[model samples]
Target: MSLCEAEKTFILHGVEENFRIDGREREDYRPMEVEIGIISHAFGSARLRLANTDVLVAVKIEVDTPYPEKPSQGKLDFFVDCSANATPDFEGRGGEDLATGISNSLSDAYRSSKAFDLKKLCIMKGQKCWKLLVDILLLECGGNLYDAVSLAVKAALWNTRVPGVKSVGIDGKNVELNVSERLNDCVPLDVSGAPVMVTVCKIGEYCVVDPSAAEEKCSSAALVVAVSQGNITTVLQGSAGSLHPTTLMDSLGLGVEVANQLNIALMETLQSAPPHFDVGFLK
Candidate 1:
């Protein structure tokens, strides 16, 4: 949505005062709710609601040949789908560009060995491996989609349970594998190092985390920071506006600080959550 000059001024003034339109501090985030194992058909699934922004993530695993260049490692792919109803910008073909950008950002964030270890997904040397496809569906867009998507993706990966292989038989060039049918014979993914992203928006001279839709329009530029294990993984710039070196550094610092806090809170919620059926997905 386009903001008028008056609305922009109001948002800018609020940012300058370190208070947002939603009554959050500069570094404060919106309230969030997370539900795991939301998709019964998928191996792993999670739904996250950050204020008005909603995202659903599912992890689907398949047995496939490992890349020739990386024989010992498995493959991980990210795909983002934006529903037309999510936002006006998502209607028609406009959302494809945004979806592609978000997908690439997630891929970059998870490329590092410290971020996610693909070696654990390997089944048999170069012949057989587990390929994880992380599918993200955007159900709503209030703002800060990068952070919402990253959080949901991490939660989904944590909920994933990879089936165990009972036996692997090699017949020259052919490889035969038998996966365990028992539901209890499954291994959960290690997501301790998974990255979480935070969007720091530059409004006037100050910066704010988790900007609302109106606050986003009033900002000149924004930085998407992905942090893994308390370390910065990727920093992406948004909008055409340029930033001064000092501002860039400051934004990065803020992003890192908020990402660490977000990660801690998310882990605490996941660990303490009890087993329950997910009813949010249907809505």
Candidate 2:
């Protein structure tokens, strides 16, 4: 399945002309499909398919005591699962390491105060706080996992609806949950400043955004940047081999530019999306 030297040169030549192998311009985004509330079991859910990369996000909430250090803030946790459905290499526990890596990276990307407002999720100062468990499922790894996962996270957060509470009663150190008469009423989470991740792959002497699987194999290095309203939330450098500092910086610059465009397109799609939209994989 590997490309020959001639085919590789053809790809490079196409990039030099500002047109890619798939006839896409540098700023053009691949066709994407998004679905919300797909999983009835989860409180909030979203499934996004970016070209070939498929991602599923689920949000679960629980009531728990706030942390001692941050009693006024709630919690938002990220957990990534690399399912075997994506590839045979991830069968059993073999993909645990990669799953942990993705989850930890997301934690670093979204834990900052500027990325998400956790205080808004707090109910009581030190007594009760809402803990959000954001779980991500990697159904397919076509090329860009970071970008796909971030998009899914934003979509899931948009679909999240927290139940409204009327009051909290405490008696004999036991807390009672009193919800409003409108049990079906829910409030949506704010996601204006949510971070969007972009990956820039360095191939030959040029950098490319949203590289294909074959292109990724030929790349010497890559940079992943999570941008929240033009601010950098997370910076990650990955490569099959080593890279120089100059090249790394150059790649990061390219990543930032690509990230901005990605955010704009995602927002546009979400704004015009309909409630009963159909998102099929075969599409």
Winner by TM-score? 1
lDDT of 1 by residue, 59-149 (tens): 9999999999999899999999999999999889979999999999999999998999999999988889999999999999999999999
| C-alpha lDDT values of all predictions | 0.89, 0.80
What TM-score goes with each of the models? 0.96, 0.90
For model 2 the TM-score comes to 0.90
Model 1 clashing residue pairs (backbone): none
**Top candidate by lDDT:** 1
Off by over 4 Å in 2: 1-9, 181-184, 240-246, 279-283
Q: What is the lDDT of residue 199 in candidate 1?
A: 94
Report the CA-based lDDT of candidate 1 relative to the real structure: 0.89
lDDT of 2 by residue, 1-283 (tens): 3779998888877777778888876545677788987888777889999887899999998888899999999999999989898867688897798788778878888888888999988888888888889999999878878888998898888878787778889997888878654637677788888888888877777778878776776777777888887888888775666667897777677777777777777667666665436443212
